[model samples]
Target: MNPPLFDLTYCPIVPALEVIGGKWKPLVVYHIYLGAQRFGSLLRCIPTISKTMLTQQLRELERDGLLHREVFAEVPSRVEYTLTQTGLSLLPVLKAIGAWGRQLKEQQAVPELVA
Candidate 1:
């Protein structure tokens, strides 16, 4: 029998998914891409996501080296997030996935009936 084409032990998709696979990570990344750096801005961009969940997701992304969290010394202690090079590299993949989603939505749309 031929060897399997993919090595299950070290599948590339597994690592990628480990880094960005979650209900909120992709949306977080998408909003960050659109210049939602501050906490309030990110929260506004994805209002359906709970504040706690958003914090957890951002911390995970930062831990995974996909984002950089900056802290400013001020009266209120401002914080912001920016994508790291690793995170930026995934932009094209995200864009392609978005395009595919739009295409699928278009394909599934019901045409209007004319009189």
Candidate 2:
């Protein structure tokens, strides 16, 4: 018998987008993918995102199984985020998205402003 055809029940990009397609999620994932990082570090990296919003994004990423949050017991508690295997699989896509964004930005730049 011929092998079953590839699953076509739904668009694959849909689920991928669902996982990484938010205003902040892709940024969160990309930074973590760059390296395991602490909560404060992420907040610094993505300025303009308020602490509450960053916290919300981190919680959602954890809930979606894309990030692992580890708490270190110390005089001051420290929390770090690392990507899960599933999350690792998604990072390259985020990188590509970043590249595409750069290209678009460059393309849209005013010639005078670019100087």
Best by lDDT: 1
> Which consecutive 10 residues in model 2 have the weakest lDDT in total?
2-11
11-103 in candidate 2: lDDT tens per residue?
Answer: 577677777777999888889988999988998999989999999989988988999999989868888999999899887777788799999
Worst 10 residues of 1 by lDDT: 2-11
Among all candidates shown, the one with the greatest TM-score = 1
lDDT scores for all predictions? 0.88, 0.86
Per-residue alpha-carbon lDDT of candidate 1 for residues 83-108, written as tens digits (9 for 90 to 100) = 98888998999988889999989977
Model 2 residue 86 lDDT score: 87
Positional deviation of residue 48's Cα in model 1 after best superposition, in angstroms? 0.2
Candidate 1 TM-score, C-alpha based = 0.84
